[model samples]
Target: MPLAVVDAQTLVDSVALGAVYALMAVGIGLVFGVLRLVNFAYGQLVMAGAYTLAFTSHFHPAVSIAACFAVVIALSTAIDLAVFRPLRGQSPAVMLVTTFALAFLLQAVARIVDVRDGTIGEPVRVVGRLNRAVDVAGVNVRQVTILAIVLGVVMLGLLALLLGRTTIGLHMRAAAADFRTARLLGVRSDRVIGFAVFLSAVLAALVAVVLTVRRPLVTPAYGLQETIVVLVGVVVGGLDRLWTATLGGFAIGFATGLINGVLPTDKTIFLPTAVFTLVILVLLLRPGGLFAPRGAATVERV
Candidate 1:
Protein backbone atom coordinates (compact mmCIF):
# COMPACT_ATOMS: atom_id res chain seq x y z
CA MET A 1 0.00 0.00 0.00
CA PRO A 2 1.36 3.42 -1.00
CA LEU A 3 1.01 5.81 1.94
CA ALA A 4 1.15 8.78 -0.45
CA VAL A 5 -2.03 7.61 -2.17
CA VAL A 6 -4.17 7.89 0.96
CA ASP A 7 -5.27 11.50 1.35
CA ALA A 8 -6.89 13.48 4.17
CA GLN A 9 -10.29 13.04 2.55
CA THR A 10 -9.90 9.27 2.60
CA LEU A 11 -8.92 9.38 6.27
CA VAL A 12 -11.98 11.49 7.16
CA ASP A 13 -14.32 9.24 5.20
CA SER A 14 -12.81 6.12 6.76
CA VAL A 15 -13.30 7.52 10.27
CA ALA A 16 -16.90 8.35 9.40
CA LEU A 17 -17.50 4.81 8.13
CA GLY A 18 -15.88 3.40 11.28
CA ALA A 19 -18.12 5.61 13.42
CA VAL A 20 -21.22 4.32 11.68
CA TYR A 21 -20.10 0.71 12.10
CA ALA A 22 -19.37 1.38 15.76
CA LEU A 23 -22.96 2.49 16.23
CA MET A 24 -24.17 -0.67 14.54
CA ALA A 25 -21.83 -2.77 16.66
CA VAL A 26 -23.24 -1.21 19.81
CA GLY A 27 -26.77 -1.90 18.61
CA ILE A 28 -26.09 -5.55 17.85
CA GLY A 29 -24.03 -6.01 21.00
CA LEU A 30 -26.76 -4.55 23.20
CA VAL A 31 -29.27 -7.26 22.33
CA PHE A 32 -26.64 -10.00 22.32
CA GLY A 33 -25.52 -8.97 25.77
CA VAL A 34 -28.95 -9.41 27.29
CA LEU A 35 -30.51 -12.23 25.26
CA ARG A 36 -27.51 -14.01 23.71
CA LEU A 37 -29.32 -13.50 20.40
CA VAL A 38 -27.37 -12.07 17.44
CA ASN A 39 -30.43 -10.48 15.80
CA PHE A 40 -29.40 -10.98 12.18
CA ALA A 41 -32.55 -9.13 11.19
CA TYR A 42 -31.12 -5.90 12.59
CA GLY A 43 -30.36 -4.57 9.11
CA GLN A 44 -34.02 -4.97 8.30
CA LEU A 45 -34.79 -2.33 10.89
CA VAL A 46 -32.43 0.03 9.08
CA MET A 47 -34.01 -0.92 5.77
CA ALA A 48 -37.44 -0.17 7.14
CA GLY A 49 -36.26 3.23 8.33
CA ALA A 50 -34.68 3.98 4.97
CA TYR A 51 -37.88 3.01 3.17
CA THR A 52 -39.83 5.20 5.56
CA LEU A 53 -37.56 8.09 4.67
CA ALA A 54 -38.03 7.39 0.98
CA PHE A 55 -41.79 7.15 1.16
CA THR A 56 -42.06 10.30 3.21
CA SER A 57 -39.53 12.27 1.20
CA HIS A 58 -42.22 14.56 -0.11
CA PHE A 59 -42.91 15.73 3.44
CA HIS A 60 -40.83 18.15 5.46
CA PRO A 61 -37.35 16.86 6.23
CA ALA A 62 -38.09 16.88 9.96
CA VAL A 63 -41.26 14.86 9.45
CA SER A 64 -39.55 12.37 7.13
CA ILE A 65 -36.73 11.79 9.61
CA ALA A 66 -39.18 11.52 12.49
CA ALA A 67 -41.26 9.02 10.52
CA CYS A 68 -38.13 7.03 9.78
CA PHE A 69 -37.37 6.79 13.47
CA ALA A 70 -40.94 5.89 14.36
CA VAL A 71 -41.16 3.17 11.71
CA VAL A 72 -37.85 1.53 12.58
CA ILE A 73 -38.53 1.59 16.33
CA ALA A 74 -42.02 0.21 15.87
CA LEU A 75 -40.82 -2.57 13.57
CA SER A 76 -38.07 -3.45 16.02
CA THR A 77 -40.57 -3.57 18.87
CA ALA A 78 -42.86 -5.76 16.80
CA ILE A 79 -40.03 -8.20 16.02
CA ASP A 80 -39.15 -8.36 19.70
CA LEU A 81 -42.74 -9.05 20.73
CA ALA A 82 -43.73 -11.34 17.90
CA VAL A 83 -40.56 -13.40 17.51
CA PHE A 84 -37.84 -12.82 20.08
CA ARG A 85 -40.04 -12.68 23.19
CA PRO A 86 -41.79 -15.89 22.20
CA LEU A 87 -38.53 -17.77 21.68
CA ARG A 88 -36.72 -16.41 24.69
CA GLY A 89 -35.92 -19.82 26.13
CA GLN A 90 -35.01 -21.50 22.86
CA SER A 91 -31.49 -22.63 22.01
CA PRO A 92 -29.09 -20.10 20.51
CA ALA A 93 -29.00 -21.95 17.17
CA VAL A 94 -32.79 -21.84 16.97
CA MET A 95 -32.83 -18.13 17.74
CA LEU A 96 -30.15 -17.47 15.16
CA VAL A 97 -32.10 -19.36 12.51
CA THR A 98 -35.22 -17.46 13.44
CA THR A 99 -33.40 -14.18 12.87
CA PHE A 100 -32.21 -15.39 9.48
CA ALA A 101 -35.74 -16.34 8.50
CA LEU A 102 -37.11 -13.06 9.77
CA ALA A 103 -34.50 -11.14 7.80
CA PHE A 104 -35.41 -12.81 4.51
CA LEU A 105 -39.12 -12.46 5.20
CA LEU A 106 -38.71 -8.75 5.84
CA GLN A 107 -36.69 -8.35 2.66
CA ALA A 108 -39.36 -10.12 0.64
CA VAL A 109 -41.98 -7.87 2.11
CA ALA A 110 -39.88 -4.81 1.34
CA ARG A 111 -39.51 -5.93 -2.26
CA ILE A 112 -43.23 -6.35 -2.58
CA VAL A 113 -43.90 -2.95 -1.08
CA ASP A 114 -41.29 -1.34 -3.29
CA VAL A 115 -42.62 -2.81 -6.56
CA ARG A 116 -46.17 -1.87 -5.64
CA ASP A 117 -45.20 1.62 -6.73
CA GLY A 118 -43.88 0.22 -10.02
CA THR A 119 -40.29 0.65 -8.93
CA ILE A 120 -37.60 -1.62 -7.52
CA GLY A 121 -36.17 1.15 -5.36
CA GLU A 122 -37.07 4.54 -3.97
CA PRO A 123 -35.05 7.73 -3.60
CA VAL A 124 -34.78 9.57 -0.30
CA ARG A 125 -34.76 13.26 -1.12
CA VAL A 126 -35.28 14.68 2.34
CA VAL A 127 -31.62 14.66 3.37
CA GLY A 128 -29.89 15.10 0.01
CA ARG A 129 -28.42 18.33 1.30
CA LEU A 130 -26.12 16.26 3.44
CA ASN A 131 -24.21 15.21 0.32
CA ARG A 132 -22.81 18.72 -0.05
CA ALA A 133 -19.17 19.09 0.88
CA VAL A 134 -17.62 21.63 3.21
CA ASP A 135 -14.00 22.55 3.65
CA VAL A 136 -12.46 21.35 6.91
CA ALA A 137 -8.83 22.30 7.43
CA GLY A 138 -8.37 22.54 3.62
CA VAL A 139 -9.98 19.14 3.05
CA ASN A 140 -13.47 18.79 1.62
CA VAL A 141 -15.76 16.67 3.77
CA ARG A 142 -19.35 15.69 3.20
CA GLN A 143 -21.76 17.07 5.78
CA VAL A 144 -23.18 13.60 6.38
CA THR A 145 -19.68 12.22 7.05
CA ILE A 146 -19.17 14.85 9.72
CA LEU A 147 -22.58 14.05 11.16
CA ALA A 148 -21.74 10.35 11.38
CA ILE A 149 -18.60 11.01 13.42
CA VAL A 150 -20.37 13.47 15.70
CA LEU A 151 -23.37 11.19 16.18
CA GLY A 152 -21.14 8.24 16.96
CA VAL A 153 -19.24 10.12 19.65
CA VAL A 154 -22.34 11.63 21.21
CA MET A 155 -24.26 8.37 21.22
CA LEU A 156 -21.33 6.43 22.67
CA GLY A 157 -20.86 9.04 25.38
CA LEU A 158 -24.55 8.96 26.20
CA LEU A 159 -24.49 5.17 26.28
CA ALA A 160 -21.54 5.22 28.68
CA LEU A 161 -23.43 7.62 30.96
CA LEU A 162 -26.62 5.60 30.77
CA LEU A 163 -24.86 2.37 31.63
CA GLY A 164 -22.78 3.97 34.36
CA ARG A 165 -25.27 6.28 36.11
CA THR A 166 -28.84 5.19 35.55
CA THR A 167 -30.83 2.52 37.37
CA ILE A 168 -32.10 0.79 34.27
CA GLY A 169 -28.61 0.95 32.83
CA LEU A 170 -27.23 -0.79 35.91
CA HIS A 171 -29.97 -3.35 35.65
CA MET A 172 -29.06 -3.94 32.02
CA ARG A 173 -25.37 -4.30 32.92
CA ALA A 174 -26.25 -6.78 35.63
CA ALA A 175 -28.43 -8.69 33.24
CA ALA A 176 -25.68 -8.81 30.63
CA ALA A 177 -23.16 -10.01 33.19
CA ASP A 178 -25.35 -12.87 34.39
CA PHE A 179 -28.98 -13.04 33.36
CA ARG A 180 -29.99 -15.87 35.66
CA THR A 181 -28.29 -14.29 38.66
CA ALA A 182 -29.67 -10.88 37.83
CA ARG A 183 -33.16 -12.33 37.62
CA LEU A 184 -32.60 -14.09 40.91
CA LEU A 185 -31.51 -10.73 42.35
CA GLY A 186 -34.83 -9.16 41.27
CA VAL A 187 -33.91 -7.75 37.86
CA ARG A 188 -36.93 -7.70 35.53
CA SER A 189 -35.93 -9.73 32.53
CA ASP A 190 -38.71 -8.55 30.25
CA ARG A 191 -38.13 -4.88 31.00
CA VAL A 192 -34.36 -5.11 30.52
CA ILE A 193 -34.68 -6.97 27.24
CA GLY A 194 -37.37 -4.63 25.98
CA PHE A 195 -35.20 -1.61 26.76
CA ALA A 196 -32.31 -3.20 24.94
CA VAL A 197 -34.46 -3.66 21.86
CA PHE A 198 -35.53 -0.03 22.05
CA LEU A 199 -31.95 1.25 22.24
CA SER A 200 -30.90 -0.98 19.37
CA ALA A 201 -33.82 0.26 17.31
CA VAL A 202 -32.81 3.87 17.94
CA LEU A 203 -29.31 3.17 16.72
CA ALA A 204 -30.68 1.44 13.64
CA ALA A 205 -32.81 4.46 12.87
CA LEU A 206 -29.79 6.75 13.18
CA VAL A 207 -27.78 4.49 10.93
CA ALA A 208 -30.53 4.48 8.31
CA VAL A 209 -30.57 8.29 8.21
CA VAL A 210 -26.82 8.56 7.85
CA LEU A 211 -26.64 5.80 5.26
CA THR A 212 -29.40 7.27 3.11
CA VAL A 213 -27.60 10.59 3.14
CA ARG A 214 -24.70 8.77 1.49
CA ARG A 215 -26.74 6.54 -0.82
CA PRO A 216 -30.21 7.91 -1.33
CA LEU A 217 -31.54 4.83 -3.06
CA VAL A 218 -33.69 2.68 -0.77
CA THR A 219 -33.61 -0.93 -1.86
CA PRO A 220 -34.73 -4.10 -0.11
CA ALA A 221 -31.10 -4.94 0.59
CA TYR A 222 -30.02 -1.45 1.57
CA GLY A 223 -28.40 -2.34 4.90
CA LEU A 224 -27.81 -6.05 4.52
CA GLN A 225 -24.11 -5.97 3.64
CA GLU A 226 -23.27 -3.36 6.23
CA THR A 227 -24.93 -5.43 8.92
CA ILE A 228 -23.00 -8.53 7.88
CA VAL A 229 -19.69 -6.64 7.94
CA VAL A 230 -20.48 -5.14 11.32
CA LEU A 231 -21.34 -8.58 12.69
CA VAL A 232 -17.95 -9.84 11.52
CA GLY A 233 -16.31 -6.91 13.31
CA VAL A 234 -18.32 -7.45 16.49
CA VAL A 235 -17.27 -11.06 16.67
CA VAL A 236 -13.67 -10.34 15.71
CA GLY A 237 -13.41 -7.54 18.29
CA GLY A 238 -14.70 -9.87 21.03
CA LEU A 239 -18.40 -10.44 21.42
CA ASP A 240 -17.79 -11.08 25.12
CA ARG A 241 -17.09 -7.42 25.78
CA LEU A 242 -19.22 -4.53 24.45
CA TRP A 243 -16.35 -2.07 24.08
CA THR A 244 -14.21 -4.65 22.34
CA ALA A 245 -17.02 -5.51 19.94
CA THR A 246 -17.49 -1.82 19.17
CA LEU A 247 -13.77 -1.35 18.58
CA GLY A 248 -13.86 -4.31 16.24
CA GLY A 249 -16.65 -2.73 14.23
CA PHE A 250 -14.77 0.54 13.93
CA ALA A 251 -11.52 -1.17 13.05
CA ILE A 252 -13.07 -3.23 10.29
CA GLY A 253 -14.80 -0.24 8.78
CA PHE A 254 -11.64 1.87 8.92
CA ALA A 255 -9.64 -0.91 7.35
CA THR A 256 -12.18 -1.41 4.58
CA GLY A 257 -12.23 2.28 3.72
CA LEU A 258 -8.46 2.57 3.89
CA ILE A 259 -8.03 -0.44 1.64
CA ASN A 260 -10.52 0.93 -0.85
CA GLY A 261 -8.56 4.15 -0.97
CA VAL A 262 -5.28 2.36 -1.55
CA LEU A 263 -6.54 -0.06 -4.18
CA PRO A 264 -6.57 1.05 -7.81
CA THR A 265 -9.95 2.34 -8.95
CA ASP A 266 -10.39 -0.65 -11.27
CA LYS A 267 -9.50 -3.06 -8.48
CA THR A 268 -11.87 -1.53 -5.96
CA ILE A 269 -14.45 -4.09 -7.00
CA PHE A 270 -12.38 -6.66 -5.11
CA LEU A 271 -12.83 -4.71 -1.88
CA PRO A 272 -14.84 -7.35 -0.04
CA THR A 273 -12.29 -10.03 -0.94
CA ALA A 274 -9.47 -7.97 0.49
CA VAL A 275 -11.39 -7.00 3.60
CA PHE A 276 -12.33 -10.58 4.48
CA THR A 277 -8.77 -11.75 3.85
CA LEU A 278 -7.68 -9.20 6.41
CA VAL A 279 -10.35 -10.47 8.77
CA ILE A 280 -9.02 -14.02 8.38
CA LEU A 281 -5.51 -12.83 9.22
CA VAL A 282 -6.75 -10.90 12.26
CA LEU A 283 -8.70 -13.87 13.62
CA LEU A 284 -5.72 -16.12 13.08
CA LEU A 285 -3.62 -13.78 15.20
CA ARG A 286 -6.28 -13.11 17.86
CA PRO A 287 -8.98 -15.72 17.85
CA GLY A 288 -10.35 -14.38 21.12
CA GLY A 289 -10.71 -10.84 19.73
CA LEU A 290 -8.36 -7.98 18.90
CA PHE A 291 -9.55 -5.85 21.79
CA ALA A 292 -10.36 -8.57 24.31
CA PRO A 293 -8.53 -8.59 27.62
CA ARG A 294 -5.34 -10.59 27.86
CA GLY A 295 -5.69 -14.05 29.46
CA ALA A 296 -9.49 -14.06 29.10
CA ALA A 297 -10.93 -17.26 27.70
CA THR A 298 -12.50 -16.98 24.28
CA VAL A 299 -16.16 -17.97 24.42
CA GLU A 300 -18.38 -18.01 21.36
CA ARG A 301 -21.47 -15.89 22.04
CA VAL A 302 -23.20 -16.30 18.66
Candidate 2:
Protein backbone atom coordinates (compact mmCIF):
# COMPACT_ATOMS: atom_id res chain seq x y z
CA MET A 1 0.00 0.00 0.00
CA PRO A 2 1.12 3.52 -0.67
CA LEU A 3 1.96 5.53 2.41
CA ALA A 4 -1.02 7.81 1.91
CA VAL A 5 -3.33 4.87 1.31
CA VAL A 6 -2.00 3.14 4.41
CA ASP A 7 -2.53 6.27 6.48
CA ALA A 8 -6.09 6.71 5.21
CA GLN A 9 -6.94 3.10 5.84
CA THR A 10 -5.47 3.38 9.32
CA LEU A 11 -7.59 6.41 10.08
CA VAL A 12 -10.76 4.66 8.93
CA ASP A 13 -9.98 1.52 10.83
CA SER A 14 -9.11 3.52 13.93
CA VAL A 15 -12.38 5.44 13.84
CA ALA A 16 -14.36 2.23 13.43
CA LEU A 17 -12.44 0.57 16.21
CA GLY A 18 -12.84 3.58 18.48
CA ALA A 19 -16.56 3.72 17.80
CA VAL A 20 -17.02 0.11 18.84
CA TYR A 21 -14.97 0.66 21.97
CA ALA A 22 -17.05 3.71 22.78
CA LEU A 23 -20.19 1.61 22.56
CA MET A 24 -18.77 -0.93 24.98
CA ALA A 25 -17.62 1.84 27.29
CA VAL A 26 -21.12 3.29 27.32
CA GLY A 27 -22.53 -0.06 28.37
CA ILE A 28 -19.96 -0.59 31.09
CA GLY A 29 -20.16 2.98 32.30
CA LEU A 30 -23.94 2.86 32.52
CA VAL A 31 -23.98 -0.16 34.81
CA PHE A 32 -21.07 1.07 36.88
CA GLY A 33 -22.50 4.51 37.25
CA VAL A 34 -25.79 3.18 38.52
CA LEU A 35 -24.76 0.22 40.66
CA ARG A 36 -21.18 1.21 41.46
CA LEU A 37 -20.28 -2.31 40.41
CA VAL A 38 -18.21 -3.24 37.40
CA ASN A 39 -19.82 -6.29 35.91
CA PHE A 40 -16.91 -8.30 34.58
CA ALA A 41 -19.38 -10.67 32.98
CA TYR A 42 -20.28 -7.93 30.52
CA GLY A 43 -17.76 -9.40 28.08
CA GLN A 44 -19.40 -12.79 28.38
CA LEU A 45 -22.63 -11.15 27.35
CA VAL A 46 -20.87 -10.09 24.14
CA MET A 47 -19.49 -13.58 23.76
CA ALA A 48 -22.99 -15.00 24.07
CA GLY A 49 -24.25 -12.64 21.39
CA ALA A 50 -21.44 -13.69 19.03
CA TYR A 51 -22.36 -17.32 19.54
CA THR A 52 -26.00 -16.52 18.90
CA LEU A 53 -25.04 -14.91 15.61
CA ALA A 54 -22.92 -17.93 14.72
CA PHE A 55 -25.72 -20.34 15.44
CA THR A 56 -28.18 -18.32 13.42
CA SER A 57 -25.85 -17.66 10.52
CA HIS A 58 -27.80 -20.06 8.31
CA PHE A 59 -30.92 -17.97 8.67
CA HIS A 60 -31.78 -14.67 7.01
CA PRO A 61 -29.56 -11.89 8.20
CA ALA A 62 -32.43 -9.93 9.70
CA VAL A 63 -33.75 -12.95 11.53
CA SER A 64 -30.31 -13.89 12.75
CA ILE A 65 -29.63 -10.36 13.97
CA ALA A 66 -32.98 -10.20 15.73
CA ALA A 67 -32.34 -13.53 17.41
CA CYS A 68 -28.96 -12.26 18.53
CA PHE A 69 -30.56 -9.22 20.11
CA ALA A 70 -33.29 -11.29 21.75
CA VAL A 71 -30.84 -13.79 23.20
CA VAL A 72 -28.49 -11.15 24.62
CA ILE A 73 -31.22 -8.98 26.11
CA ALA A 74 -33.02 -11.96 27.61
CA LEU A 75 -29.82 -13.34 29.03
CA SER A 76 -28.88 -9.98 30.47
CA THR A 77 -32.26 -9.54 32.14
CA ALA A 78 -32.11 -13.09 33.47
CA ILE A 79 -28.70 -12.49 35.02
CA ASP A 80 -30.02 -9.45 36.80
CA LEU A 81 -33.06 -11.26 38.14
CA ALA A 82 -31.24 -14.41 39.17
CA VAL A 83 -27.86 -13.17 40.31
CA PHE A 84 -27.41 -9.46 40.72
CA ARG A 85 -30.88 -8.72 41.99
CA PRO A 86 -30.67 -11.16 44.89
CA LEU A 87 -27.28 -9.79 45.81
CA ARG A 88 -28.31 -6.18 45.70
CA GLY A 89 -27.17 -4.08 48.65
CA GLN A 90 -24.23 -6.38 49.19
CA SER A 91 -20.69 -5.06 49.44
CA PRO A 92 -19.28 -3.87 46.14
CA ALA A 93 -16.46 -6.37 46.53
CA VAL A 94 -18.89 -9.27 46.82
CA MET A 95 -20.86 -8.13 43.79
CA LEU A 96 -17.67 -7.65 41.80
CA VAL A 97 -16.49 -11.16 42.66
CA THR A 98 -19.86 -12.59 41.70
CA THR A 99 -19.48 -11.01 38.26
CA PHE A 100 -16.02 -12.50 37.90
CA ALA A 101 -17.38 -15.96 38.70
CA LEU A 102 -20.30 -15.38 36.39
CA ALA A 103 -17.89 -14.47 33.60
CA PHE A 104 -15.98 -17.71 34.05
CA LEU A 105 -19.17 -19.76 34.29
CA LEU A 106 -20.58 -18.34 31.08
CA GLN A 107 -17.29 -18.78 29.24
CA ALA A 108 -17.04 -22.35 30.39
CA VAL A 109 -20.56 -23.09 29.23
CA ALA A 110 -19.77 -21.62 25.81
CA ARG A 111 -16.63 -23.72 25.55
CA ILE A 112 -18.56 -26.87 26.33
CA VAL A 113 -21.28 -26.12 23.81
CA ASP A 114 -19.24 -24.74 20.94
CA VAL A 115 -15.87 -26.41 21.23
CA ARG A 116 -16.93 -29.78 19.85
CA ASP A 117 -14.53 -32.39 18.52
CA GLY A 118 -11.63 -30.06 19.24
CA THR A 119 -13.15 -27.37 17.06
CA ILE A 120 -13.38 -24.17 19.04
CA GLY A 121 -14.38 -21.39 16.66
CA GLU A 122 -17.51 -21.12 14.56
CA PRO A 123 -17.67 -18.93 11.44
CA VAL A 124 -20.49 -16.43 11.36
CA ARG A 125 -20.81 -14.99 7.85
CA VAL A 126 -24.28 -13.57 7.81
CA VAL A 127 -22.89 -10.09 7.15
CA GLY A 128 -19.87 -11.31 5.31
CA ARG A 129 -20.45 -8.91 2.44
CA LEU A 130 -19.61 -6.10 4.77
CA ASN A 131 -16.00 -7.17 4.64
CA ARG A 132 -15.65 -5.65 1.18
CA ALA A 133 -14.09 -2.23 0.90
CA VAL A 134 -15.22 0.72 -1.18
CA ASP A 135 -13.39 3.79 -2.35
CA VAL A 136 -14.18 6.91 -0.37
CA ALA A 137 -12.20 10.06 -1.21
CA GLY A 138 -9.38 7.97 -2.62
CA VAL A 139 -9.31 5.82 0.47
CA ASN A 140 -10.61 2.30 0.80
CA VAL A 141 -13.13 1.86 3.60
CA ARG A 142 -14.81 -1.37 4.49
CA GLN A 143 -18.59 -1.31 4.30
CA VAL A 144 -18.73 -2.50 7.87
CA THR A 145 -16.56 0.42 8.89
CA ILE A 146 -19.19 2.76 7.62
CA LEU A 147 -21.84 0.71 9.32
CA ALA A 148 -19.94 0.84 12.59
CA ILE A 149 -19.54 4.59 12.43
CA VAL A 150 -23.20 5.08 11.62
CA LEU A 151 -24.30 2.72 14.34
CA GLY A 152 -22.11 4.42 16.91
CA VAL A 153 -23.40 7.88 16.07
CA VAL A 154 -27.05 6.82 15.95
CA MET A 155 -26.87 4.82 19.16
CA LEU A 156 -25.09 7.59 21.00
CA GLY A 157 -27.61 10.14 19.82
CA LEU A 158 -30.53 7.96 20.80
CA LEU A 159 -29.00 7.30 24.18
CA ALA A 160 -28.48 11.01 24.69
CA LEU A 161 -32.12 11.67 23.87
CA LEU A 162 -33.26 8.84 26.09
CA LEU A 163 -31.29 10.19 29.03
CA GLY A 164 -32.22 13.78 28.36
CA ARG A 165 -35.88 13.54 27.33
CA THR A 166 -37.51 10.44 28.81
CA THR A 167 -38.78 9.68 32.28
CA ILE A 168 -36.94 6.38 32.49
CA GLY A 169 -33.80 8.17 31.42
CA LEU A 170 -34.33 10.67 34.20
CA HIS A 171 -34.72 7.88 36.69
CA MET A 172 -31.55 6.21 35.41
CA ARG A 173 -29.61 9.44 35.74
CA ALA A 174 -31.00 9.95 39.21
CA ALA A 175 -30.04 6.44 40.24
CA ALA A 176 -26.54 6.94 38.93
CA ALA A 177 -26.19 10.14 40.85
CA ASP A 178 -27.33 8.55 44.09
CA PHE A 179 -29.10 5.22 44.06
CA ARG A 180 -30.31 5.28 47.63
CA THR A 181 -31.60 8.80 47.37
CA ALA A 182 -33.18 8.09 44.03
CA ARG A 183 -34.89 5.00 45.35
CA LEU A 184 -36.13 6.89 48.34
CA LEU A 185 -37.42 9.59 46.04
CA GLY A 186 -39.60 7.15 44.03
CA VAL A 187 -37.13 5.97 41.38
CA ARG A 188 -37.85 2.25 41.10
CA SER A 189 -34.56 0.47 41.58
CA ASP A 190 -35.57 -2.64 39.74
CA ARG A 191 -36.82 -0.70 36.75
CA VAL A 192 -33.71 1.45 36.51
CA ILE A 193 -31.28 -1.42 36.87
CA GLY A 194 -33.24 -3.60 34.48
CA PHE A 195 -33.28 -0.90 31.86
CA ALA A 196 -29.55 -0.29 32.28
CA VAL A 197 -28.78 -3.97 31.81
CA PHE A 198 -31.15 -4.19 28.88
CA LEU A 199 -29.50 -1.26 27.18
CA SER A 200 -26.09 -2.66 27.97
CA ALA A 201 -27.03 -5.99 26.37
CA VAL A 202 -28.35 -4.24 23.32
CA LEU A 203 -25.03 -2.48 22.92
CA ALA A 204 -23.21 -5.79 23.44
CA ALA A 205 -25.19 -7.46 20.68
CA LEU A 206 -24.35 -4.59 18.38
CA VAL A 207 -20.71 -4.95 19.27
CA ALA A 208 -20.87 -8.65 18.54
CA VAL A 209 -22.35 -7.99 15.14
CA VAL A 210 -19.66 -5.52 14.18
CA LEU A 211 -16.91 -7.67 15.65
CA THR A 212 -18.16 -10.76 13.87
CA VAL A 213 -18.02 -8.86 10.61
CA ARG A 214 -14.40 -7.91 11.24
CA ARG A 215 -13.50 -11.32 12.67
CA PRO A 216 -15.99 -13.97 11.66
CA LEU A 217 -14.61 -16.81 13.70
CA VAL A 218 -16.65 -16.65 16.88
CA THR A 219 -14.95 -18.22 19.86
CA PRO A 220 -15.79 -18.66 23.53
CA ALA A 221 -13.33 -15.95 24.49
CA TYR A 222 -14.50 -13.46 21.92
CA GLY A 223 -14.90 -9.91 23.24
CA LEU A 224 -12.86 -10.56 26.35
CA GLN A 225 -9.84 -8.58 25.20
CA GLU A 226 -11.87 -5.76 23.77
CA THR A 227 -13.89 -5.55 26.96
CA ILE A 228 -10.74 -5.43 29.05
CA VAL A 229 -9.30 -2.68 26.88
CA VAL A 230 -12.51 -0.70 26.95
CA LEU A 231 -12.72 -1.09 30.71
CA VAL A 232 -9.25 0.36 30.99
CA GLY A 233 -10.23 3.18 28.68
CA VAL A 234 -13.30 3.87 30.80
CA VAL A 235 -11.13 4.20 33.87
CA VAL A 236 -8.63 6.31 31.98
CA GLY A 237 -11.40 8.63 30.81
CA GLY A 238 -12.82 8.97 34.32
CA LEU A 239 -15.21 6.38 35.66
CA ASP A 240 -17.22 9.01 37.45
CA ARG A 241 -18.70 10.46 34.26
CA LEU A 242 -20.28 8.69 31.29
CA TRP A 243 -19.17 10.96 28.42
CA THR A 244 -15.63 11.04 29.71
CA ALA A 245 -15.56 7.26 29.81
CA THR A 246 -16.81 7.09 26.24
CA LEU A 247 -14.12 9.51 25.11
CA GLY A 248 -11.54 7.48 26.97
CA GLY A 249 -12.55 4.37 25.09
CA PHE A 250 -12.26 6.22 21.81
CA ALA A 251 -8.91 7.68 22.73
CA ILE A 252 -7.31 4.35 23.52
CA GLY A 253 -8.65 2.68 20.41
CA PHE A 254 -7.46 5.52 18.25
CA ALA A 255 -4.04 5.33 19.84
CA THR A 256 -3.89 1.63 19.17
CA GLY A 257 -4.71 2.14 15.54
CA LEU A 258 -2.19 4.94 15.17
CA ILE A 259 0.53 2.80 16.67
CA ASN A 260 -0.39 -0.13 14.47
CA GLY A 261 -0.22 2.06 11.40
CA VAL A 262 3.25 3.40 12.14
CA LEU A 263 4.86 0.16 13.23
CA PRO A 264 6.33 -2.14 10.61
CA THR A 265 4.11 -5.17 10.00
CA ASP A 266 6.83 -7.47 11.32
CA LYS A 267 7.01 -5.43 14.52
CA THR A 268 3.25 -5.53 15.23
CA ILE A 269 3.92 -7.82 18.16
CA PHE A 270 4.81 -4.75 20.19
CA LEU A 271 1.32 -3.27 19.83
CA PRO A 272 -0.06 -4.39 23.18
CA THR A 273 3.14 -3.45 24.97
CA ALA A 274 3.11 0.01 23.44
CA VAL A 275 -0.56 0.52 24.29
CA PHE A 276 -0.21 -0.56 27.92
CA THR A 277 2.98 1.40 28.44
CA LEU A 278 1.14 4.51 27.34
CA VAL A 279 -1.73 3.55 29.62
CA ILE A 280 0.63 3.24 32.60
CA LEU A 281 2.22 6.55 31.81
CA VAL A 282 -1.17 8.22 31.64
CA LEU A 283 -2.21 6.66 34.94
CA LEU A 284 0.98 7.72 36.65
CA LEU A 285 0.51 11.30 35.55
CA ARG A 286 -3.22 11.59 36.14
CA PRO A 287 -4.47 8.88 38.44
CA GLY A 288 -7.91 10.40 38.49
CA GLY A 289 -8.53 10.50 34.70
CA LEU A 290 -6.83 11.81 31.58
CA PHE A 291 -9.79 13.90 30.57
CA ALA A 292 -11.08 14.90 33.97
CA PRO A 293 -10.54 18.52 34.92
CA ARG A 294 -7.70 19.07 37.38
CA GLY A 295 -8.74 19.01 41.04
CA ALA A 296 -12.24 17.87 40.12
CA ALA A 297 -13.83 15.92 42.92
CA THR A 298 -13.92 12.25 41.91
CA VAL A 299 -17.57 11.76 42.64
CA GLU A 300 -18.77 8.31 41.64
CA ARG A 301 -21.68 8.74 39.24
CA VAL A 302 -22.91 7.16 36.08
Q: What tens-digit string does per-residue lDDT give for candidate 2 at 187-239?
A: 99988998999999999999999999999998888888888889888878887
Q: Model 1, stretches more than 4 Å misplaced?
A: 1-4, 265-287, 298-302
> Candidate 2 — which residues are off by over 4 angstroms?
1-6, 265-287, 299-302
TM-score of each: 0.95, 0.92
RMSD of each candidate relative to the true structure: 2.0, 3.0
CA displacement after TM-score superposition, residue 173 of candidate 2 (Å): 1.0
lDDT of each: 0.92, 0.88
TM-score of 1: 0.95
Q: Give the alpha carbon lDDT tens digit for every residue of 227-281 in model 1.
A: 9999989988988778999999899889778877767778677877866776676
Which candidate leads in TM-score?
Answer: 1
